[model samples]
Target: MDYSPHPTTAPSPPPATGSVSGKAVRPGDRIFLGLSRGSGIALLVIMAAIAAFLTYRSVLAISGDKSNFFTTLDWNAVGTEPKFGIAVLAFGTLVSSVVAMLIAVPVAVGIALFISHYAPRRLASPLGYVIDLLAAVPSIVYGLWGALFLVPHLSGLYGWLNDFLGWTGIFSYSNGAARSLFTVGILLAIMILPIVTSVSREVFLQVPRMHEEAALALGATRWEVIRMSVLPFGRSGVISASMLGLGRALGETMAVATVLSPSFLINASLLDPGGGTFAQNIASKFSEADTFGQDALIASGLVLFVITLLVNGAARLIIARRKEYSGASA
Candidate 1:
């Protein structure tokens, strides 16, 4: 009997040599993952500790005899009843930060655009490095420069604005003293400029080469290419950078205290020598504070903490949306 030739069956490929979805992990990866999780837990613990401490101290302040915490303008924390509120401080923070953003965001975007798209490579790197260096400079040094150099020089400019734009109200000056919210804003702008510029430059540089090339291929001018391709792509990054700058501006203590002569009242004109920020108030008084005063200061710090958290959260949401948009486009 002749047996028919058996058809050959290919041996199944050996099972994948490595770990499967349900397979045991290597000891090294497990250890690393454990360490990462532990570190994250530790970070959360630290944040909790800080929040608890701040809340504890602030409750002492708010629960004390102070008036409606939101409405009272008085900030005297050294009386029998120690009245204080963050209204002026909040206003000052918002005003100075807004001014700094107005000055810094445009200039920073321009500088970033230049470095990313316009400048020659050799020059661009060095300038970028210089700006990065500026960001590292100590706040105290900036404060000294603002007080010694900027304040004196700004007096003349203040006078000019008063003379020419007094009718505009915002630029009107009272007595030619440059130690006003405007001056503080200018100083804050200078301090935050490098930070915004560096971040914005990096973001702009991240625009896809293919997109830039496509724009150029379509006969778009270099500026137009940047406007259409780079800026829109980096809009989220720009907002984040601006918020970072705003954060710094809000918390800038020494420079603001050095430049601002705080008055309790709120004024519409940026030229008025009025207002105090949370950081400024804290720095100016922390060293001399009694227990209640220190508590009040901590309470003000709580307000700042809340504001910063809100800003950063908004920025995170904006970035998340942009990332989604980019993912969809890709």
Candidate 2:
């Protein structure tokens, strides 16, 4: 018998374990990648849809206006050739939000620092939990508090401010009710306090132990350590948190509607009772608005949406411009 009549096959080599082999995609990873990409696309589509709808409705309101939408002080859109404008509302909204940020950011940062670094270790966790709880309080509850309690209690302070700063005009008090832009700003600052505090506290808590230790080893005082090591590292996080608070202040509806006595005219005095904000104006007038009036409110709402988008976009751009922002965020 010839030996070539039958042959045996060799065993196959084991799967390669080289660097190129290590780069092979796993099935699970491919699935995850596809899911994430699809989710991002869905989000973009939803955002685009919302923008298109808001723009469409706003244009319908603006098309028949007899007055300049940007300059007119009146918001009377009742009859044919209706006319209205957001000038007063925009002024009030921006002023109130600016005041809120001015009051909230520094106070929030200080409170967060105390909770994260200055509070007793035994007390820190409980204090943080209580601060977080403040954020969960209902907006309507805050509205009631502002209307019933804060507005009445602020009269003395308003009087004092008017006595000293009345010449500036914005701080002038003309014996009107305390439901003014200044009052609304104070209420908004209190409302957004929890959000900024909680976010900043978390960021402060994340500061690397090594960074603090290095500062200490270099003979820095506690305050100096925080100033040099913590604040610089966490600046971006604080800015982001403040932006979140500002967004809350800008879009707040019920609290503002309850606290503010809205007027279409721009008052020089923030301590006066008459000033309108976009969200507050809409809430106060929507039920009584005719078809044209409702459309006008929609147009103002579109302006507010654009304002908020621009604010958040500006904040993101600011954060992105900081070289340390990415590292701090991580």
Question: In each prediction, how many residue pairs overlap at the backbone (N, C-alpha, C within less than 3 A)?
Answer: 0, 0
Q: Which ten residues in a row have the lowest lDDT in candidate 2?
A: 1-10
Models 1 onward score TM values of 0.87, 0.85
Alpha-carbon local distance difference test for all models: 0.86, 0.88
**Which residue pairs clash within candidate 1?**
none
* Tens digits of lDDT, candidate 2, 5-85: 343433445555444557787878779879999999999999998889878888888987898999899888887667788
TM-score between candidate 1 and the true structure: 0.87
Candidate 1 error regions (>4 Å): 1-36
Q: Candidate 1: RMSD over Cα atoms?
A: 9.8
In model 2, which regions exceed 4 Å deviation?
1-42, 317-330
